[model samples]
Target: MKINKFLLGAFALSVGFASCSNEEPIKGDNGGATDGEKYVTVRINSVGDIGSRAATDNDDFEGPAEGSSEGNVTKENIRFYFFTADGMPFVMSQTGVNGTVNTNMVKPDALNVSNTNGDEKTSLEAVLVLGAPEKYVGNRPAIMFCVANATDEAAFEQFAKKRLDAIPDIEVNTPGEWSKFRMTSSTYKEGEGEGAKVIYYTDISDNVKDTKDAAMANPANIYLERLAAKMRVKGLGEYTVMEKNEDGTLATAQYKIRDENGTTITALKVNLLGWEPYMTANSCYAVKNIDKTWTNTSLFNGWNNADLHRCYWALAPGIVSPNNNTIPLYDNNKFKYGNYDGNKPTENIVYTYENTSYQPASVTDRSTKATAILVKAVVKLEGSDEGIDMVEWGSDYFTLEYFKAIVVEAYNADKDVTNQATAKDVVLKKNTGADARSNTWYATVKGDDFKRFSNISWWQNGITSYFVNVEHLGSKYGVVRNHIYDYTFNNVVGLGVPGDDPVNPQDPKPSYLAARVHVLNWHVVSNSTILQ
Candidate 1:
């Protein structure tokens, strides 16, 4: 895909050379030129298939019938040739069969042999101009003839006159007896695959006659006629490009089908080309329901369902991250508050115990849900970067904002508390708290309330340390240690009923819900005194 500058130049040069060589020869003015100096250019017109049928078992009658079975009909081998006014014999060139000949550098035996083979050889009429090296100017008429053996002479002559006669025309006895020929006119582009050959035939003209005898008398005319016949064959069988009557839409053309008589049957008003667009529109409508479902249900909720995830997983690999955290376990037996010695604790004492129990709350699923929503939003925004925005705010800033949003969402969802905040907030706090001691902090939440503070830096930082410790502690001890701190008496305290009763009894709420409950032990203690 990456083309070097030098190679590109070389390719361009090669293309130019090929283009120059492929250009069709233009006829020059030959006024008053001598017969020896005359020149002409001839080109191929068309090609087509010719064949005969043989009887086979498929056409046989089941019971004993009078007629024999007919075999499947197929086209025979195709032939191609060119038609031109130039008298020169057909010579295969790099571009195509050319008819122009160099009279000045004539070969020893030029035009010396007769074309009376009547089978293989053919000839054509060419303009004759007489001229010496410096005096060549005008052109004159020259007789056209072809050499073919006994078997092909008659057919070849007939073909030549039908094509080269002053008024080119043909006559058809029956519709099925139409003569076919190939027609090609367009110039080939450089580096393209081999040139295409078009086949067509002249429709019958009532006035034209089948002069087989006259064509045979003049053999050169036969060659010209055959060449013209080859050029007129239509290769793209029976095609039409129709325009819609109502709105100018392009309609498909009709195609030729075989009739019972084993002849090509041309159908009128057929619409073959329109089928593709019709099928495409139908398929879109068929899938309308699936698209509606995705639009109606929020994309975030749909993604969370395991089934939806599996579907997406099959469609696009590596979409879901591999490192999702497992759900935390909760303890049902642990007491929220410390046990008292009194047989019946006073109201104040009970209230105090209740308030203390609410110090720490358990983690909730809502936190995970919110984080999942944030991640989904980030991904969605990222996906829309390629779309056009109509708003005046301009697309560049929105593109930058999209990137910023991803980073912000990811940082906020981190278990570490320090990194949790909008970019603006992080910048302001960093500036204001420059003098304060800075250290890598960690956090662990005991109750469901962990969801609310999941975005905080302290928790995210703490999770990292906990993860590292668990890995170093190995499976046997890691699980036991996690059980103790992850679900203990202190951790489960604040997860119960509200301790404080609101003045409005209906709004019963916890008075002192504990934000977090975990040991804050750190291996690398910061030296705050040394910094001061």
Candidate 2:
């Protein structure tokens, strides 16, 4: 059985404009009538568009599918922060805010922008008072950061106080830690995406006029990115057996199964049960980060959007220490599972922190890990009212009773007699050796101890599971923040690996699942890449 999966971003970008009056400036303790105080109005875009060709290759993009654009780009609120050229928090005139002198953080009310076309594009216009303006008399402030819809002011207050480089290193213990907090660079510099969203004052200094009216006319623009990545699964249609022709085209074939008597069963059915995410990260950083030394530079071809200065790679939490072995299998919020037949709109869509690993040397290597989807499915055969529970060995499938019976038959033939008990012992050894007469290996025809003797996997109720790795564009293995991974299975080659253990799944046999993939840049509508 082969499974084809596709990765798509369902959220598209739209354009909405909001503005703040320049007549009034924030004359608080931080930026009052201080001699060095300077104020600038910034036009902020909190949503990402599929048409921007930012961090994606979709230049001629249209928009997202109907009803697919949810609350992806809606900016309910806004937060503003300023930093020095050296990447430290600009000290505020007050001493006791957020436990630091950086009382410069601003929480503006939600703006009511006109969504003329109902595209869900949200924007914010805020007057950012540059403290110690005299310090940057002729020069521009280093950069500014914008956050949207961050409701937990107390939790995010800690993050807002940290320096730029330190932000990405901060650990978010759980996936639900302040869910709506978003961070994006104000300036897209060379190494900007790796750390903080640094919107450089120099990059937009040309618009930093002395007066608020002058600055508002040509204000700086910055895009905010969410700290989490989304994943969704849909049953495209009934599962089919697919094969490649000599010309590289695909051909469909019906799957065949044989009964105990070796009679081919013409009637077979496969059903889509449910799915869950496996090997996913338990935590992540507040800001996205990446490894600069990754040798596969091609993996990053479209990773960085020149227009937006956003990088797609984020080093997930626990990746640095390499203790990401434990998967939260029971966490309903993160490891979501739901029943959806093929082509249903009710499948569960979940979010995850960025998770990645170095490309393993072999298929069996487990030292490094990446996030993969655990698909649960069952196969039904004719004449069997229940799903068939079978075990696979070498290249064939058999029920536990049938498998043991075959071994017993071979043992009796070798001994030239049906010694029953004597032959059963040797056949149960899980492995056959030179000492074939040993009567120590014991196994019953039932489920209990037989599995201990045989190394074969046992599928319960014919439940076959496939662990499909989530692929990003290029050769890298990981899921990045602000992107959506949509998976659709296209083929199935064999009875999948036995057992329904989503936590620790066995490696699939060669070609058990076949895939073809395509990744396009994100823009106005939800973007999708195919994995066949």
Q: Give the candidate number with the greatest lDDT.
A: 2
Per-residue lDDT of 69-182 in model 1, one digit per residue for the tens?
111000111122222333222222332112222321111111112233364332221222212212222122122222111112232233332232321232211112112211
- Model 1, 373: alpha-carbon shift in Å? 62
Model 2 Cα lDDT, one tens digit per residue, 1-532:
0000001222111111112123433333442221222345455443344335433344322222223332333323445565666666654543112112235455533333333225433332223333443432233344566554444556457657667566556666443543343444422335433553433222344544555555545556555565556666655333543444668555553444333677353544455466666566766666656655432364555555546555555556555433234333233343346632334432465566667655544322233567766655666665455677555554456665566666556544544443443323433323234532111233443223443344455555665555566677655667776666655555654445543232333344432344433222222112222222
Q: Against the hidden reference, what TM-scores do the models get?
A: 0.13, 0.67
On the 0 to 100 scale, the lDDT of residue 147 in model 2 is 54
Clashes of each: 74, 39
TM-score of 1: 0.13
**Candidate no. 2 TM-score:** 0.67
